[model samples]
Target chain A: MASPAYIAVDWGTSSFRLWLIGEDDSILGERRSGEGMTSAAQTGFAQVLQSHLDALAAPENLPVIVCGMAGARQGWVEAGYIDTPTSLSAILTGAVSVPGQSRDVRILPGLAQRDRQAPDVMRGEETQLLGAIAADAKGEQVVCMPGTHSKWVRVVNGQVTGFSTFMTGELFDVITKHSILSHAVAGAADVPADSTAFESAIKAAFNKPALATNLLFTARAGQLLHGLTAAGARALISGTLIGAEIAGALSSAGQGAAITLVASGRLQTLYEDAFRTLGLTYTTVDADAAVRRGLSAAAKAIWPNNERKS
Target chain B: MASPAYIAVDWGTSSFRLWLIGEDDSILGERRSGEGMTSAAQTGFAQVLQSHLDALAAPENLPVIVCGMAGARQGWVEAGYIDTPTSLSAILTGAVSVPGQSRDVRILPGLAQRDRQAPDVMRGEETQLLGAIAADAKGEQVVCMPGTHSKWVRVVNGQVTGFSTFMTGELFDVITKHSILSHAVAGAADVPADSTAFESAIKAAFNKPALATNLLFTARAGQLLHGLTAAGARALISGTLIGAEIAGALSSAGQGAAITLVASGRLQTLYEDAFRTLGLTYTTVDADAAVRRGLSAAAKAIWPNNERKS
Candidate 1:
């Protein structure tokens, strides 16, 4: 195995993922847990980090680079934010070091669109943006990062002109579990995915995003009127939220801007399907790889020599 | 005081209201409770009705007219629906009699729009529509009934052309109580209303309804970036939802259709503010009176003599 060069952690609101990178840019070790900011806040952020490092048996002096909610105001050490419109690479230079830590630890700052009309902020996605887009990329790009809070960024050349956050994933969750739609989607988890219902919902919401909430009601109405299955109801909710989000995100984008989607696992498949259903074209970047690559970029930028002795 | 003519009941998803109507159409007695459909389903619908009726000391032979969820499939009895493009008065004729009841009880039928693409159903609001709009009313009318499941009905010359059900109020409730935005709105109930924030959100969402979910996130972002208070966050969510709902509801209406708002209490005020913010003119109808009037219409149609010893 190549000797470990540095550590990279993507510490989000409810998730913790740490990666030990090798000198040759290979994965040397890995750790993942639910000890994200919420849990870490309760159980001391430094203690949580050290426990993970101890379990991985990482070197004592191995410098660490972090991104996401760990840098949030409520997070450890408060890494703060970098105001837009800023170069994507500005995140690399805006890393805030953790004070009183034995190891050299740094957390990347998030991006904040201080636009009074549309004020928005993003934490972990900024790192993903840093890694997903090429360093010398030209032309406009509409980058979408899907999650609990889906982010759509307007990138011109390397600059992030602005971005918008859609509460799509969280809304889906709450609506499915907490709203009247919950009864409509009960037992859906055991069934196979409903692509037809999903595609139709995507088209409907994409065509009339204003009718998004009304569209959500159709989950129950469809079941009552057309015998729509539980799986179909679930898909309808998911597709409607995503479709409306895409419509809003692209509303302000330049015509024919290259669409870049950074997502992993289920979200990756869902968004790709949405884009296809909407007849929109887009490129895909693995979110897991993107965040890791982002943390790696930050590590190399902060520790140029990649030397343990430094 | 005149003897009781009939008992009018509006039993909804989570609320139940009963009123004893005199021969003069006056409210002789009234009772309200949380024993709506969900609760009555467990406590026995007939028993719940009897408990409330007994509380009012209504005559044993007094006929009762019911509307709302009491007629749903899982309700007391499946009163079924009156399919649309039908006349509003059809609801009076379509009510189904509850079997084995001592009293002449009739459950009002809901309205169902089986448009294949936009299938929708409303149990209680049909009665409200019957009372809110006159039988001889002419021209196109857009009736806005704001509630948990807000029903926006399109009436053309007394005929129910079609309607849309927006899960606006329910979405607002769930998002506020269950989503991450819940944190942003904590303690909002303790603060005064923020009309400025609400109005701006209304305009923003009304103009760009597609950006609703994105606009919702601003509640949190606004707090972080602009020091927005909990009240502002609550208002933002409310306005965004209502604004989007109005935008969708009116999207298909004929140009300059008279807007009729049927609501009471907080919803009445909020939707009124929303309409004013969007520069839309609408006349308000007391929701309580509309439902009562609707039940009264049903009672009179079913029991024309209103005789206790029929």
Candidate 2:
């Protein structure tokens, strides 16, 4: 068997995961680093790369492919984002060369939407979505990846058509931490996340005779008017935001399209139920698994014509 | 004139300002501390207070009157909040007492709105609003204080009848700093604030379709459709958010009221003009001067028997 000869790195704001791939497109070993591009910006990323590789037998003559925030302008090197209706097939055929990397370490450009009413952009996540779509037969599907910045993507014919990110989690954190909503809800961090509160808030956010900003006041107001506790109020705020995102995405991208929630953990269950309650069809995929598969697929694309002989 | 005996403090989230208020209600000496309640959460505010006092000669046996974040939950001491439609009358008539070094000190409570559609709260700044209104006898005015958290307050019959806090500035900071909007504009830390750009954005924000959040995307979208520059696009976002805030506040509390903007600085000036354009009667006040007036009123409230003697 031909030994592993290349690496793929998924570097984001808070963490980094490295995959060592064999010539057969199988993972030989994987490593995780707490030092992501965002935090290790001043410490120099290439230094951390050497250490991460050293921990994994210090393999020689191996090229590295990178994705995510590592390509942000503030990253180790910028992997410029390509506009949407973007595809790996198209990117693979029309790739831009990033200069000055150790042993052919190339950064994958993100996907963006310029023509849309809102100019939406994505980085490493899109490449993974591309890898996911490439693994499937040509069909149109909506992939919802929920995170600090939740994105709803439209993939058609093995190509990423477009996507939009909702500042759901950040806004949640802001409103809860900074707004009076924090006083109403209790134990939000540790709450088992009762859907009753989330469901009701969703209904309020969409049906209210209100402004978007005023919705927040209702969070603080709910405590007084309805005796909503701090945690409950916060849960309502979360529900309202996520619910709004779902409603917005439905109206924008997945109005008639099939949907799959590419998320895991409790949040995955939440998304699944959210979609179900909305009468929207969705299937769940393991997040870590999807990322692994994506990194491997990207590795395969970076090196063509070389097959692993076992 | 009675000798200066007391100190009045209005310490808040980002900056601390104090007035050595003499018995005649004249400012004896003034000082400011970069150390505010927000940053000192983990570092012990008592230490900060001591250090600041150390700089100024520790005064004799006299009381200190303070009104602001020095009394929040995460403040030096949680002086608690007074529910809204709350006026200086209630605060002065029902003031809370506190212990101090060799003398007594009082921390005035911030105003909170529980009966309003949503529960909203404000501290420190309300005192300034009270002071501003106290200086001006113009009855029944809507006061706008714009900053990281902007407040549109209604003062009727010398009492703060109702008010709401808008997270306008913070939202702008977040959207510009962390969201996709960041990419549409330069991420330079010292980027100059373009008033023209800001004004245009405020106009766009108030423009029709009545409202749409994806509406803000026009900033980035215009860049694509018409090749808008980053500066102009950024201005649109700034204007849209502030405009939306004005719209939100207008619909929320500032509606159907005589409006006056009790704030200064280029940013506040921009908002004052926006409010005027929106057909709201708006006025601007110098923040520092108003803050001074607020402390004086608070001092007088605390020591009514010790009235300013000619």
Q: Which is the leading candidate under TM-score?
A: 1
Give the Cα error of residue A40 in candidate 1, in Å: 1.2
In the order shown, the candidates' DockQ scores are: 0.91, 0.15
- Model 1 regions more than 4 Å off: A190-192, A307-310, B190-192, B307-310
Model 1 TM-score is 0.98
Q: Write the per-residue lDDT of candidate 1 for residues A1-310, one digit (tens) a residue.
A: 8889999999999999999889888998899999999999999999999999999899998999999999999999888889999998899999999999999999999999988899999999999999999988998999999999999999988999999999998999899999999999999883229999999999999999999999999999999999999999999999899989999988988758889999988999999999998888899999999998888888888898885543
Reference-based lDDT, residue A42, model 2: 79
User: Scoring model 2 with DockQ, what do you get?
Assistant: 0.15
Residue lDDT tens for model 1, B142-215: 99999899999999999999999999988998989999888999998832299998899989998999999999
- Candidate 2 lDDT at B141 equals 74
Q: lDDT tens digits, residues A1-310, model 2?
A: 5587687788887788888777766778889978887777979888877788888874666877777888877888776767777665554433344566556677777776876445666667776675556455477788888877777888777777777666676666655654545566656564426577777666554443124555655665566446666666666677667666676666656477878777778678767766755667777777767766766666667676434422
